[model samples]
Target: MKRRKFIGLLGGAAASWPLAARAQQTRMPAIGFLRSSSSAPSQFLATALREGLKEQGFVEGQNVQIEYRYAEDEKERLRNLATDLLARPLAVIVADTIAAIQIKAAATTVPLIFASGGDPVAAGLVTSLNRPGGNVTGVVFFATLLGAKRLELLRRAVPNAAMIGVLTSRTSPNVEAERGDIEAAALALGQQLTVVDVNGEDEFDTAFVTFIRSGARALLIGSGTLLTTNRARIIALAARHALPAVYPHREGALDGGMMSYGASVADAYRQAGIYAGRILKGEKAADLPVMRSSKFEFVLNLRTTKALGIDIPPTLLALTDEVIE
Candidate 1:
């Protein structure tokens, strides 16, 4: 009878062992994603990020979960929403710009991966780029002031323009700093930069009026995603006023703006996705140094140039990575 009891006990223990193993395997890691713009996910980056995660064995509904929060209309709410997600066991949090600001303050221990359009060190997100030193490290969209290069490209597209207009958001947090960069670049190029601040549809009229009044023959627009989203209206306004315009990113050019010169947004976001997957595979955020955009896209829309009565330089057309006719 003692031998029979011993065998029975062994069977029970074996069954219980699998239970403990299953318990350990069942606890899914979670990630929190904060999007400041409604169009963020619709872009190719979001999809690329998900694809990266899948490659790293992080099947969204299977091994890991992500809590998504979007402050679509009111970007001001990103921080508060991120704070709410802080109550959970988040393995990593992905944010950008103002959304990153809130995530940094909400968790002291959780890892953060950010892809912002500003200086990470200047923004107080990390100690340095090579060694982020803490729970933060990602990529920067504004690698440098490519503003003047953009202006030069616009001039090439519209060779007859003797004056160029600059449109920017007077209310952007980095407005003044960006203005200085653009001014310095324009000065170095011996090109005059006329500044026009637009904040709303009505303000656009006065802003364009001021641009023309300043004798700006072409428009070089600034600001970050805020300006990119309003590209349709800006493009229309530029066309209506018969002024050639240069935008910061290819998206705007694709949206009908005359030309764009800047880092490839699609590739940066793809890298973000790759980073996210690496983190899931036991790579620490601190170990992964931030990367600058090595690839810059020069996009020119032949259709837009024709509509503006401008002739795109053969040199500029030859340098373009993609020309939309």
Candidate 2:
């Protein structure tokens, strides 16, 4: 070959090398993060998920890529968002309970890791907790089943209240289960319960009004993405009414709700992230048993309690995992 041709060939190869490297970087494995709620309220959960991914040596934007889709609490948008994610070449999908249900309905073949507060079996997300024999498996925090526990705690905070109001979401997958649990507990405790369901923020005022009219002296906020997303508004309403309310997640107490009892939502998300990382590393979702989150936190906000002129029972305080002063 001519000397000039050889030099030109080398120059072309060097230029192509950078393009090749860029192409390779762009081809990094991607995972989809889908949620049925708004992003701002659940930012901490997302951070926890990233931390878990990091634990498995997968960092977003470095070795793995994450594509996020949020429905902003609109149930109708979930299927569309999921369909969009499914169109991509995703190694796995990490989604909240409702979003996971919708994705499965879409007949997606990709591995799915769900962070759910409800019963995965009841919701048909999986076959069983011990063996989730499908392309879907994830973390269950049992937030739905904790209604009875929350009711017991709420009664401790307001022992003499003739009626306790329960606020739940109509759209929640766990609504029926949570209602049954709370009702059974209420009956067992000889507590009169007035349960109200709201589908959106617009219906909150009506729900509160119903509770007030029903002579509900205390409140128990139920588990659901919608309820968790609109916690601030519900907290304000409870405060305005001077009602002592118990919430399902720690964030509620952190944001000024009187108290909260349930599993650590952030931890559940982290567990789902870990599962997603493992799936990316060639583990089948079917082979990985559904993980039940073991970390449960009962947070009591002394400030909120004091503001409402409510006293926390000594026995209940003893059982608290955290006291936010």
Candidate 3:
């Protein structure tokens, strides 16, 4: 009887040991990263996000596992990718664009941390930026506001231009939604707006030709991951057309666009990263307040302006965060 009792006790202890070990093994959260742009690993933006995560004590490989998926400009790929990622028990899903919309369409149960270029409310990603009612929340760029500011800066840079061409990707995720904002800015500046729409990577030349024929004296390049990816072609086209152009990214200005004014992308990435870290640390997405960019950066290229015979105003020069002489 004693030997039988000992064997029963030993069996019970063995059964409970695995459960105890699992309970104490330090649960590592999983982060699912999905983006519309190329996963520019070398970008300081990626580093900033990691730094923010580290600040929350979430080590990428040790304490947390990050499953990175890049669509690299293919919208359809995000849908399929989201479906596959759903199989994993992700702690948080960082959906960084219209890609978020796609991810949500596929997986509604998983909490989503989205970083979007347009109004979150309008995109149907969340109920409100402050209190995103469902299992989704993150950040907004308020791209419309950014567009208006970019136009304001462009007008300051080229005060004499009467006709302004706004170049946008026709297939951009939020192109239709952003038209009104750009239109309003054009009216405010009292400049004739020639909205040039390019639908594909190969359509830039056709659009620039149309801009010239349409009597555009200057250009306003829309902010989109797609357009920025083809920065070299865009810059070359602007130069070939001899049009003074403003872009939404500093990289564009650095590549010789006349000017740029928009959210500090790296700053937004860091902010998003912090939110991801919080989620990884067990913070609910709905409770984590989504933040808009606090600052916009202005970059000016004097050489590009000179090529187009546009002399930037002193007032504009004074406001620039960076100027390439």
Candidate 3: C-alpha RMSD after superposition: 4.3
lDDT agreement with native, every candidate: 0.75, 0.91, 0.78
Ranking by lDDT: 2, 3, 1
Give the clashing pairs for model 3.
none
TM-score of each: 0.84, 0.94, 0.85
Predicted model with the maximum lDDT: 2
Q: Give the residue spans of candidate 3 off by over 4 A.
A: 1-27, 40-44, 307-309
lDDT of 3 by residue, 1-325 (tens): 9999999999999999999999768667888877665666325555666777887887788888788887776767867778878889888787666678888777767888776667777778888878887788887765545777777777777677688888887656678767778898778767788897786678888889889998887889886666866777899998998888888767788888888887766666677778888876677888887888877778889888787777777877889899898
Model 1 steric clash pairs: 163-217
Deviation of model 2 at 73, angstroms: 2.1
- For residues 1-325, could you state the per-residue lDDT of candidate 2 as single tens digits? 6999999999999999999999987788998999999988878888999998998999999989889889987867887898899999899999999999999987548999999999899899999888898799999898899999999889888998899999999989999999999999889888999999988889999999999999999999999999998999999999999899999999999999999999889999888888888988899999999998787899999999999988888998999999999
Better of 2 and 3 by lDDT: 2
- Which is better, 1 or 2, measured by TM-score? 2
Residue 280 C-alpha lDDT in model 2? 83
Model 3 C-alpha lDDT versus the unseen true structure: 0.78
Question: How does candidate 1 score on lDDT?
Answer: 0.75
What digit string (tens of lDDT, one per residue) describes model 1 on residues 1-325?
9999999999999989999999888988888877665565335556656776776767788888878777653546765688788888888887666577778876788888887666777778889989988888888777236776776777677666667888887535466667778788778877876887665445888888898888888898885545655667788889888887888778878888888888866566667767877887788988999877877888888898887677766777899998999
